[model samples]
Target chain A: DPQLHEYMKLDKKYRSIGFLSARTGGAPHVMAADEAVKATNTEVVSIEMARDTKGGAGHGATIIFAAEDVSDARRAVEITLEAVEKNFGNVYSSDAGHIELHYTARASMALEKGFNALVGKSFGIIVGAPAAIGLVMADTAVKTANVDVVTYASPNNGTARSNEIIISITGDSGAVKQSLLAAQEVGLSVLSSMGEIPKSGSTPTLI
Target chain B: DPQLHEYMKLDKKYRSIGFLSARTGGAPHVMAADEAVKATNTEVVSIEMARDTKGGAGHGATIIFAAEDVSDARRAVEITLEAVEKNFGNVYSSDAGHIELHYTARASMALEKGFNALVGKSFGIIVGAPAAIGLVMADTAVKTANVDVVTYASPNNGTARSNEIIISITGDSGAVKQSLLAAQEVGLSVLSSMGEIPKSGSTPTLI
Candidate 1:
């Protein structure tokens, strides 16, 4: 849509804005967005799947939430992250996929706003999934590790059904490591549950 | 990715720019970009798969071609389109898919830049399969029918493996009709060749 220049600013009441990009399933992305809005006092400012060349969910889904309080915004984002963290990369089919999650506690180089939104922080790389897994990962990384995204293809978005998602974040090397660890932990549990229903008697809450 | 705020000025010599987005397989997207550059006097400016969530090709792939001559740029885009047009939606497997192609010669509403880069041109829609078919369709429509795209989804990107692609273009009803017909014709030939070798002793040239 070429109305790319169209814009509006929220009043001071909506001074804080939270964004979530579930780079994976539309099912998960929509669900996460729904949960975020329902679980918090945030308003859905914009929500839509990507309309890239193929149009429609070509790039998965993105949601923006606005709140009067930054904490509320942050919390809403965290909720979305957790939702995506758990849902996006899971393989519900008979266990047929590999989950390659890595944990790095230290990094050497720093980057600027390279990941989804990380800035001036050395980054860690994220790769996993069937589609659009990077967005949700960033949502989680920012919340859990206080890192900024360095960025790139959520991974294998180019490869038809590469089943790999990748994301990079920047922060103190420790934060980058934490971000990677946090995402990898969730990835293992979710991807490991392929074809098996992991009991979720309790509603998913942001950690 | 946040350096989105950065800017550049193309020299007058490179005033013409062509962009191609193959919202489907990374293989096809890269091939198309390569073919575009090889086939014409255009320079590659940027090329990458989507990084929406899982990052890396989350949205397929996009390539930019810059040329001093408008024809070169347009031709480059057309070649990319033709390349994508032929490659993206094919099912090199036994025909197990349905090809739903529609032709609408008359459009009811006017839109402004709704599809790809189409401006208030009263659009026609395109939808077809595996991934990002809409983009290559737009490239064809713009070149062949002189129509603009009225957008919203290549379709089914949000849905995991829905195998659907959609895009809309705007123009005179006649042009819209032509665009649809042309795309449908191509889609039928390409998709119908599923799992079979359609002899292509002759290279694909823009019609």
Candidate 2:
């Protein structure tokens, strides 16, 4: 029980990065874990899988850990897989199972830092003609994202000409990057006018 | 069960990061989870704490997965915490216990990449005293570090004079900044060579 208590502390202290999948004995073993292991300066601890892929004949679970730093996080994943293979008896053994994992530092870090950056930032999009509406759709995405950017366009002089748009953004560097990327994607979407446009905007941009 | 099965699948996917802690009645609970719960995501099937913490406290249990992905992993942690909270009849209650959860991308990608980036980097040092030994020491550090540039200088003359030593280094450009910093620290250790004179350098030119 004390061991459990310590494990909980280790679990609580480190950050988790991604999920992994494996199969053992025909049963599936799916696990989500952090990038680090819990232990004293020199001790090793095992993290049990939370969601075991069961019923089909699989055994064992994938372990995940969050590294203290980027380098450490990466190392943790490698070590965990090696440990799994050792525990299950073979990397390619059908009875031993499989391991699948993913990295999301950029996405995870951005989400965490981006939300805080989003506080109070505001903006709007302008729409006039149907083509102008497309720009509006694009602008909506910028408004909701962490970056504080706004975009708009002027309608062409002709009766049915498209619009020329301008996008401007302001915020912390990371948030600004996210906003810029989002805006660019949406802007492109509208300019291309893929599929049928939505009502009003008819061609709203996807986030 | 089917709904739980679906939820479990959703939970097993994706990278998830969170923290854990102890709650009332000694139960364990997840403190925070990101993108764990969603309308169409997998539901958490159960929550189990590690029965051991190595030398600390809390419950210990591995998570078996139904599938693996970022979203599924997030859900597993969230649902486990929720279940614990429900059993304890409170949210954020201390009686349950604590376990931080983190989802990493892959096991192999965690440690080796980071380690590889740290070994065999460049180093340098400077000493203000004319101590041949100091220069020798600097050379040793440079070789040990396996770096490209190792430059150091001592005072033009020898007087056992106390002077500030400035050290600078440039090398590999591929080592971790921390490792480079370590090299710098090593250089500092040899800067004055324990006030010993060189064993083979020619006597200083008399001014």
Candidate 3:
């Protein structure tokens, strides 16, 4: 509880935030992250290298920054982008595709939650498909075990066409393992059935 | 700084984290979020309503939670999933297709960055396409104004096929506006040229 209290206080301090994501990874990504930090008076929150399930490679990296205000955060993002382009223009094509910037006037619940999860002691994750199937999996996972549901999302990890879904849970190691197993059963079933769906001619063909 | 100190303390407290995302919105999503909280000794991190950019509709919501340990977090996720399914089976298909869960053993840099961005004062965003084109746009935005680039991504908003890219920046109202305008010019250019590409005869034909 005291920690939670501290978190709340921290949440209030950096009322501005910024997120940068690139589709490619490696040196450019690292350089960009560094530039962002140097560009403004902000703290680096995260630097994540996203996996590419389809290509079986590193898809990209997402960098997050916390700034004292929106202006500083914005400056950081701009500096990083420019710096990345200047240093690694060629890599830009593969890495610098999806870029997003969002700012809030107050503490963001989503960010706080993400931070809490990051500092957590234990965690579990489940990835599946067909959004609907994932829900079923999550339901089973929770029902069969004593765990906490962190979050779930569709088409995560750059598997947009795959329709894959992901579910995350946290708890004691035993509970997490039990929950994951239960969820895996559901995920595997869905994955197997996915291939069984009879080809429907009605599927739209993009011209 | 005091707030940040508090945040660090709080971050140390919750060593386990979890996340759950549902594709459907409204009652089912809300119900699941509530259930997860009630089922465990965890803190709610975020509840987000996703926007369906491609389909032009509401995608659903995502819930994040923090717990004292992994076991509690896992339990929370499980409870929430079951409750949502029991109450809204039909909505599950539309909203629950994408489910994901994740856990961490220690502090997560990514989560912290996300939190910082979320709490920022003000921000700007740009969504473009073809990863490379997005980079060009990012360059233009930074070069044209005194804005900070928060983040950017390719084929954003779940449109893996669409190849749409998104970019975000933050700064003073004037700078944000200027940066967005500059980026928009690049985005429009890319969008316009997208249709002029000659179709290849060898394009795969799905039966």
Judging by lDDT against the true structure, name the best candidate. Answer: 1
lDDT of 1 by residue, B100-170 (tens): 33332332111121123233234455544444444555556567877765454543443234445556666
Best by DockQ: 3
Specify the CAPRI tier of model 3. incorrect
Once model 1 is optimally superposed onto the true structure by TM-score, how far is the C-alpha of residue A29 displaced, in angstroms? 30
For model 2 chain A, the run of ten residues with the poorest summed lDDT: A26-35
Candidate 1 RMSD to the real structure: 20.6
DockQ of 3: 0.03
Highest-TM-score candidate: 1
Ranking, lDDT, top scorer first? 1, 3, 2
A37, model 1: CA deviation in Å?
Answer: 48
Q: What TM-scores do the predictions have?
A: 0.34, 0.17, 0.32
Q: In terms of docking quality, how is candidate 2 classified? A: incorrect
| Tens digits of lDDT, candidate 2, A4-88 | 1232234544443322323221111111122123211111222222111222111223233444455555565555455443322
Winner of 2 and 3 under DockQ: 3
Residue B29 lDDT in candidate 3: 49
Backbone clash pairs in model 1 (N, Cα, C under 3 Å; residues 3+ apart or in different chains), count: 60
